[model samples]
Target: MTTTQPIGVAVIGAGMAGRAHLAGYRAASTMYDAGLPGIRLVAVADIHEPFARDAARRYGYQRAETDWRAIAEAPDIDAVSVVVANPLHREIVEGLLAAGKHVLCEKPLAPTVADAEAMVRAAERSGRVAATGFTLRRSPAINAVRRQVTEGPLGRVQHFNGHYWCDYGHNSDAPMSWRYRGGPGSGALSDIGSHLVDVGEYFCGPVRGVRGAVLSIQVPDRPVPLGAAVGHSAAVEVSTERRRVGNEDIATFTATFASGAVGTFSVSRIARGLANALGFEVFSEGGAATFDMSRPAEFTLADSAPPADSDGYRRVVVGPQHAYIAAGLPMDFPGVGHGQNDFFAWQARAFLEQIAGLDRLPHCPTLADGLHNLRVLDAIVSSATADGKAVTVQ
Candidate 1:
């Protein structure tokens, strides 16, 4: 059997997304091998030593480092995944790119528009692969929608509606973290809403304007943590004292696309019983389609606008029609459910290819793409601060 040299890779941040990245890299070799380079799980880094070490052991990485700079400086590491928090992205990404290592940072790019812009500049200067964790772009069913929008059936996209709601912060005693950073470009709008912004651009086109937005602080205060906190819904000790939430809990906005199609998007961290409820619909003159991974392996489409009495959506099972589904499974048909990790593995393959200098695919969200979404998000906050007035996104 012919073999290729393993490309050394590292993952920073041992939190939730970090584990997903580990699994994706591990499975890439097994799931998709065409033009795939040999991969070596080299290291995992986190500020908290225990967390980093634990992830390394579980994921079979060769080393665990408390300082991310160690991974960046390590001569053997060819690429690194920056799964750190939003505020920390610029520093870690810039460092990795400067060290001549390709990097993949998780979404929202950074906490503020300025920070995202700086990261984009660094990526442009580095000339190495720089990608964001926009895993949904690889969704099999969603890709089916993209195919038709770009080629087959759907006429000019007229409107887009997206909702990414969650109940992780519904509890009044949730612990404080950098997620709730106040003023602007923070909270649910920047957290979950950024993904929706990307979705809008994917299905329709770039957002030309954010006409207005309403931001709400539903759960004003949360229990102050006595010590380090874990996941969003994990149990952690907290003091009786409360800290006012620095950002919003719920946000809704209206956007106009470059293609003249308008869109509406909303996100909430406090919506009860809606854990990861991400769903969207695109409407055009001829038809409409809806996709929600929350349902897993299913999407609805009305291929053409029927008579008013017969207008309805038809269930489309994820099958051979969607090209990427075959990569995740032995068969190229629908009804074979797609797990969240499947998307991650698909994303990993593209990232590895870029790092290997093989076939550079078209859809890995670059720092420039991330900056575009950040600009839209920044405009949302700007519009909200001005009391629901119109704001053109730069």
Candidate 2:
């Protein structure tokens, strides 16, 4: 006798992040079939038929729909992956929860704090598993760092610095995308700063308060696509048709965590020569720990107790012994090919395992995590608008 897979999965949205989720699910399914419990990719949904169709075919989904509601309400799909833009998060997530489907939503859960709170509440009341895509928390290196800090291997945590920098805005001609908009919780802070904020919380604990500064530069006026050209790659005369963006391309903030740890974070889309350069460092009484996405397979550990003659950071290569490391696929096998592949794969597996009743979901960075991140983001915007005056992160 053969046992069937336990759950049916649906992927919502067909953009960059949606594609990543599809790839992750597909990879997880492949891995599961090779000994792990498997999940079936049953359906996919997107506003764009082409994207939905193509992704469904590529990811081995059995069905595709242009309306997300169809996937959300489909009795066959047991879980939904929400990878749409920030503005659509609340509606989609609430709908999925109401439909009795488990949800895994991408980061920056909602466009506003109120909406994020509502989403959290809905998830809580629905009695369904809900998870936010704060991918950094799943990183092996970061996990190792978290272990060191928590276990006192790194002694008392003192200072933390996290930076997420990219060159997406350096091109003066880069067409206006939802990411550069204001109302959608777009801009540097929500797009990338969310990750930094999550990392800060993960390492040092909750943020009590924060102060920040924001700046908008580079292609202040972007050409808007005309009728029938929306979401298509096209360029026309630059027009300042939309209200000057109320969001910033760069933001830097400082915060005090619940553990009394002081931390600093900076996020930028205008930095030239950088592409998705996310890195963080934790300074403790005994030592310092660092991880740079640019150098994926290695983490650095400094000896705070180094002899007076020499004090420096030692590089630690993540190998087979690291957590989540299965036999053949050594920690360093993939290298930077997918900077956080192991972590992401592990997260996917965990989600699948939870659906299969094999494990309990982590209580961390849950819906509450999204709300806290949003509150911090709101505080950042308020502080920036107030000329860097400190704002309490409620």
Candidate 3:
């Protein structure tokens, strides 16, 4: 049933990515032409008082909340975005779902597979619109490449190579926090590789197994923070005390897809000179395509139909005709650049649309898909633990 009344929405986190969710909800109504229900910016919540207050003021939320429990218990909130820490996801999400709120959770659904499984079951019981945040899939160029793979021209995908590199952990002076507390695949692999793995599966198919996996800890220890650390930025007053890092800074592995395609994935948070470098190359029987997240608006296609002399990758600049572009942008024209945060807006719109029952097929990944991603990541870590032996994705 289409929602007849405005959906009351609140965000439970007020930090970097949390702010993005706030903005996305604020802009979700303006992005598409669907007669979507109006969104009521009810509240913004954070443990830090200033963060919640600032976000509420900036995003036009009605009020600021210090506890997420307030959002869960509120009669006015119908939907909520849980953009908090991974370890806290299950508790917050379960609480919200039990309170009858539709949830949009951040990726790496939980710290472990058991937690993810529990979340999936909880979402199943709620019968609410529960989604995982895989915002990279909303990229117009990436979706265009996915179409080429599935809708012909590219033929059968043979190999997929993806890499997500960033410098968030490159500095030795960075403070230790929840980001460095996980084990094996929980580091860079889960941080960004989760998106890469999901994108690979979106293009080729489900990964069956993984081998030759390596998880490395470039910085063994980090300084303890004397103040609150926001997002990936280093803390300003880190104490002299250092803590041992419990997870890898880099992860690399080869994967076997169900479609008989082989793939490679490399992710690192300590890579030098690369900030938000998420890209992939797909080699198929008929053609090949490449997409770099650094250049979010276009992709390179090497179609095999051209003559031998003209056999080179052609740059395809995304336009209004591209996926999610026609009505997604204000101008909705060619060469109008969109960035990473725009993906969040599109994601918010799609989530709200699903809740409104305006679409048949799901536009975002479900909690089950998030569970599968965690399984694949667990398999990768298992492979690394077994001296790079092939581990089946269970």
Candidate 4:
């Protein structure tokens, strides 16, 4: 009744995002293995050999290489996950596209807008499945909110309030790494703020312009690591060498959507006692809905119903009726909790469907979407630097 095809997959950059993508492929291969063909974890490439080898064994890859070009040119690899630094995205993506491999690149597409636009153009002409990792879109809560917005439970968006807060940079000795020094588009805005930007568009519509912004570095400088840095907090190799942080550690911005709905967004990497505490509340003429990633399993929503009492938020446990839940878990199992990796596996399934030429799945964010997000990040920076002056996105 259904057709299945084998796919060869490789992941570049064995860092955090790289590990997540590779593991997702493994989970999807087994969890959603109905008509899905077995995927070969062909290889993993990283700048560091230890990183590559470690990820390869941990993720069940067939091989590991220090050079990403090898994976790009590997004849056996049909699909690639570009999970490297933002500065390296455009070149690696275009190269992989030229080799005719389907690519799912990590978000904040590139360190600059021009590079992202170029990648978009390359993806357009390559005729391959090109996806960007705005992976949070796969969350069931996000999908539930989207359904409400489109189905009229929430009428027209009037205002959106969102925040992505983390305590990773609250420490004084945090080492400076690629994420901290990836030039203009790096830092809190592009790091976590990119997800907020994407979620904003998903909740309302495309933001037409930015009305104001305040971007600041919470920690003025961080100790430089002399050796290989690991994770968010790594000890410097016997040195107190420090470097100035070039980007904002926090960004607060106001945006106006094309439909004239206004919104405010705040992102902070130095918010103590919180890790990945991202959430949003949208107010529409019809009603309001709220979501928090910390909850992961449920969201609070309300409709414009006649109030007699009990007119507060309604807690929705993500079940089979919600998006992508049945694919990863038993929907009938009430009170079942979902985690972030579940979202990643679902995203992998979507990409597999994309490669299979199925149009019913959620369209993974394209290079164009990534570029638009970059523009929004850019406008926030511009607005912030100009002391909160409005900056229009073109």
Candidate 5:
């Protein structure tokens, strides 16, 4: 058998997520004794040259570039991580795939259904592995919930309820970024609702239809940055400017999965006092199971068949023995505890393995998943505009 060297990876963003991916790659390299069969960080790319250079130096990459195309077309680059803005996802991913590089893009896939569909076609034509950054699906605790649900422990899934609320964008003075904009898939829906949609589908199945509402509220006008504030050195009158905030800050939807399971989901960026509360509950004939991303280590499983005396939800502790756990790894390791679990490394390793022909493509959220999410998101938006009329997922 011929042994292949580690695949070369290029990350094309220097934002928070880009940093996380870099950290993940470095951690994986260390975990595998710097000898993982097929994966290595070869280059880092960002529009900010200094940030890219800094990341290269800190992450031990051999090269850094300001233009993503340089890394996308480099012969040494086998896979590209698209961590740029949502508007850039389709262009960069399409370009990388056209250049014959495998791609792992962050979520929402693209700003629209058409672009996301194009990305799917490109991946199909390239015959290269393509994965989305739906890291929550790989969580050990969530994996346990999936197993229990699939094993008939949850019985026939009848309903699902979920909330993904955070305060990161709650402050009125939160600076205006791509996330709060209208174009380029900005807004709370694509930014955070995408994850909740992915989570709902990952756990319940395909969402076949939706009925929901989307709303945006303003707390304050963000002050221009110091550099831009020189001309107008005062806080600009900031109100809930609906014209400036085009996308919904709050999204609530009721959906029916392909499996006939009904569900209700809510995602918000302005929920006061909530700091990253992504949670869900599955109710079935057998009982119910609940999960909260904030509390990464445990899930609640309620027994349906009870004598009524000891009937209650039991917390399941995800340990090293869990299906998603890597052998020889500690259960309480920082990565595992923080949801970076082996799953994060597994995503990179799995993509590398697929490219090397060592394994069939492992399921991560694919372009098809992105399409499904987009359709559902569209439905939710339409329903909201039409005053909560039920809308079928197209």
Candidate 6:
């Protein structure tokens, strides 16, 4: 039974990605005309009061909260976006779910697979819509490529080469934070590799095993921050002490999919000259398709049986005809481009749609998917630990 009452929404982080979730929720209703109920920008929460207030004021939320529990306790809040640190996910999510609030959590579900499994169980027992924030899956270009490969035309995907590279950890002076904590495969692999793994599985199929994995740390230690750090930005002031970086800054792995597709994946936070360079190529018996997040508006397609004298890739500009294009933007034309943040809006819409019972098959990744992603990461870590020995995904 769908209610016409406005669905109250809250966000539990006031950092970089949290702000994106705030804007996404504000723009969610405007993206599509699924007769979604009005959304209430109820509250913005962060342990840092000032940040919370800033985000709330910037996004037109009703209030700011320093305590996330306030959101769970509030009767008016129907849904929440948990964008806090990875270690804090399980407790907050469990509390919110117990309060009967639908949740949308950012990726890497938790620091460990065991934690993710517990969260999944909590979501199941609560009977609430628990979604993982695999934001890249909302890209129109990526979805179009997925359709081509999974349906036909790209018949029997044989191989997938994907990489997500960033420069966030290039600066050794960057202060120590939770992002650099945990064991091997917990840093760059979990930070960005999770997205790559999810996309690889989304394109081909579930990863059956992983092998030939390597994890490396570029900067071994960083100065302790003198003040509270937000997101990945380095703290302006730092103490004389330095902490040892416990995880890898770069990760490379080979995966075998259940559908006989082989995948080569790489992720790095120390890749110089690459801000968010996520791109992938899927090769199949019939054809191949490639997409670069840097060029969000288009994809390159190579048909095996091209017309005579034309045996190369052709650029395909995504237009309103593509998935999430029609009614997804105010100007749904081909050249009118969208960015990473627009994905959060699309994701928010999908989450809200599921909450309203407007759709049975949710477009967003479920808690189960999130757990599976962690398992894949665990396999990579185990492989790297065992001298690159093959490790089957649990």
TM-score of each: 0.94, 0.89, 0.98, 0.95, 0.89, 0.98
Clash count in backbone of candidate 3: 0
Model 4 C-alpha lDDT per residue in residues 17-41, reported as the tens digit of each score: 7888989888776554366666888
User: Could you tell me the lDDT of residue 55 within candidate 6?
Assistant: 94
lDDT (Cα, tens digit) per residue for candidate 1, span 1-394 = 1225578888999887888898788777766447666788999999988889899999899999999999989988887888877888899999999999888889989887788889999988988889998888888878788777888678778999999999988887778877776655588988888887888889888998886698899787887887665458447788888888888899998999889999998899999999888999988766788988687588888975467788789888887556566655655556767777788878887788777766645448899888888888888988999988888889
Cα lDDT of all candidates, in order? 0.83, 0.76, 0.91, 0.85, 0.74, 0.92
Model 3 root-mean-square deviation: 1.2
**Model 6, 1-394: lDDT tens per residue?**
3667899999999999999999999998887676898999999999989999999999999999999999999999999999988999999999999999999999989999999999999999998889999999899999888888878588788999999999989999889988998889789999999999999998888999999999999899998988877788875688899999999999999999999999999999999999899999999888999999999989998876677798888998999988888888989887898888899899999999888878732468999999999999999999999999999999
Better of 4 and 6 by lDDT: 6
The segments of candidate 3 whose C-alpha lies over 4 angstroms from its true place after superposition are: 360-362
Backbone clashes per model, in order? 3, 0, 0, 0, 2, 0
Per-residue error for 57 in candidate 1, Å, reads 1.8
Output the lDDT of residue 110, model 2: 89
Query: Which residue pairs clash within candidate 6?
Result: none
Q: Put down candidate 3 lDDT per residue, 1-394, tens digits, no spaces.
A: 3576899999998989999999999999997675888889999999989889999998999999999999999999998999988999999999999999999999989999999999999999999989999998888999999889888699789999999999989998899988989778878988889999999998888999999999999899999999776688785689999999999999999999999999999999998899899999999988899999889999999987779998999999999888888878888989988999999999999999988888832478999999999999999999999999999999
With a 3 Å backbone cut-off (N, CA, C), the pairs that clash in candidate 4 are none
Error of 5 at 355 (Å): 2.1
Report the alpha-carbon TM-score of model 1 versus the true structure: 0.94
Error of 3 at 232 (Å): 0.7
* Model 5 alpha-carbon drift over 4 Å, by segment: 1-3, 30-36, 183-185, 226-243, 304-307, 328-343
Per-residue C-alpha lDDT of model 2 across residues 1-394, encoded as one tens digit per residue: 1224667788898766786777777766544324445577888898878888888898788988999899877888887889887889999999999999888988888889999989999989998878888977767677777778888479768999889998877775656667767742368889889999888888888888987655454457565544312221344344555434556778887898878999988888888999779999999987899999898777899865677777788888765555454432333353423356555556676676666655443432578778888988888888777888889888
TM-score of 6: 0.98
